[model samples]
Target: MPRTKPGVGKGVLHPGAGVGKFEVRRFHPDPDLAPFVEHLWTVRWDLGDAPPFVQRTLPDPAVHIVFERDRSEIVGVVRGRFERVLVGAGRVFSAKLHPGGLAWLGAEDASRLTNRRVAVDALFAGVDVAAREAAILGAASEEAMAVELQAFLRSVAPRASAEAARA
Candidate 1:
């Protein structure tokens, strides 16, 4: 099936925004990780001298790992709508995991994480958080950031339980 274009239904959260102000890119996971991952998305923006932009979205069942310049977090499914304000010039790389994919990361119940944000180290224990953060934030472009993120996921290689597999 052909993938829908990015930003197609994204207007509710980013209304009146011109397409040229920022860039949104999506990528499929590596073949081995496809079942556990829906896709990766990166949003890069350079709104020089423009006012802050507020973006909102309806709740989604999938979990997400969001990487930013100073912090990274494992976000659980949100039961309510989500909102964020974009300020300055920066980018964010995120992994949208399949609804059941949280089990692969040792989460017993994905719903428990709903509306909660956990430190990356809490979910990815033993991984070098600082080094990984540096690599991701230091990437030159969105594509490079995606590559770094995919490599990190591959290195961790979390496994889904039988129930998750069925999901």
Candidate 2:
């Protein structure tokens, strides 16, 4: 089964190609992530540049591009991560970057997600996934040694309930 919701109108990765794999463009400020962004700027500056900048900044690691099939447009985006600070006796420690998972949703779906009401709902579904992974890995809660990871997700929800409903 697909990881995303059911009833999503058959999303095409590349509009002209007409089937199979969608193109994903990775965006990054440094040489590490987005090479295309750099190439574009070499020619000249355009207001069109903003999307790449936004894409480069998102917290999600898996994200590369936002494909709008109808219009055949692609935007760069990163998933957003939720940081949990694991604190202990009289000290601040252990920051873990948890992939919120909801970051993968396209712009239209994600913009609606900002509502706190929706966020809390998704958290209930996704938290267990994170907790279980942490427990399995034996990332024991402790008072020292802070660890911080930066990444992103579509949302914290267990499933794409809202996106599903819309479809």
Candidate 3:
């Protein structure tokens, strides 16, 4: 599986690409968690008085746990391009799960989630959605947010099965 992103204009189709105040930051996964998680990344943007920016990307076959200011979700594989509109100033922190780690700590089959988007509660039980989301998104810095995300994952993530590793 491709753990690294397709560079530049390929998978990334954002205007000005890596230029401007919009920034994408990726933090390495915890050493022990590396087998299941590819990375924890955050996108921060500040447009001040400028027009909203449109960013698009060719998503890979994987699951993503996205945490925004107001909502958190688990998104399955996207067979198409992903697009988002950026306005004002905001940041989003997310964890990209490997294909071999799809089951997470749940018994649900990863195949059942193809092209679907579900609430984080659907996958993680006994989690305080508001509290966790607040702890991560409300963090003062991206590093702090990444740390919170890793802690959250460590609390619930599962070990990859041998068979699942080859999927």
Candidate 4:
């Protein structure tokens, strides 16, 4: 199930997950985007002078659009576990897509992207991806980042098809 509340990271597997040292939150999609977007999310961590922390989790099989500074990506469904190393200080805003959302959003098929990542431009073409990424990442707060991402998601909602929507 998608997390509907803020400050929750159900998939996070760590001591005192999604709080304090590791901050995360989930925001529900707007009504118009409900079909394609499961939820929008943000993750922030500041390890400061400490050693890098490796985050581990068993992720659900779903597509995701992760927006970072200059490194935004369309992440495909992962069949296994997930891990990412966190260090220093950083934050990212992302959208968790529904099962058929990838196809609806422009990918030929979700299966083609399995265990792979493509530049966000592959799907959301024509937009200034770098500029958009910068705006989202540069937002002053997590809620602001989600708003930026939600606007982007809403911008693409019109292109989705009914068949793909049902998928």
Best by TM-score: 4
Question: Which is superior by TM-score, 1 or 4?
Answer: 4
lDDT score, residue 139, model 3? 80
**lDDT value, residue 107 of candidate 3:** 40
**Candidate 3 residue lDDT tens string, 17-126:** 54886877777776666777878877888999988888888978888889987668888888899888888998888988887566655547877788888888778887
User: What are the models' TM-scores?
Assistant: 0.82, 0.19, 0.82, 0.85
Query: In model 3, which regions exceed 4 Å deviation?
Result: 1-10, 14-18, 158-167
Model 3 CA lDDT for position 52: 86
Give the clashing pairs for model 4.
Answer: none
Model 4, C-alpha of 166: deviation from truth (Å):
11
Instruction: State the lDDT at 66 in candidate 3.
Output: 91
RMSD of each: 3.8, 18.4, 4.5, 3.5
Selected candidate, larger TM-score, 2 vs 3: 3
Q: What is the C-alpha local distance difference test score of candidate 3?
A: 0.76
Worst 10 residues of 1 by lDDT: 1-10
- Order the candidates by lDDT, highest first: 4, 3, 1, 2
Better of 3 and 4 by lDDT: 4
Best-fitting candidate, scored by lDDT: 4
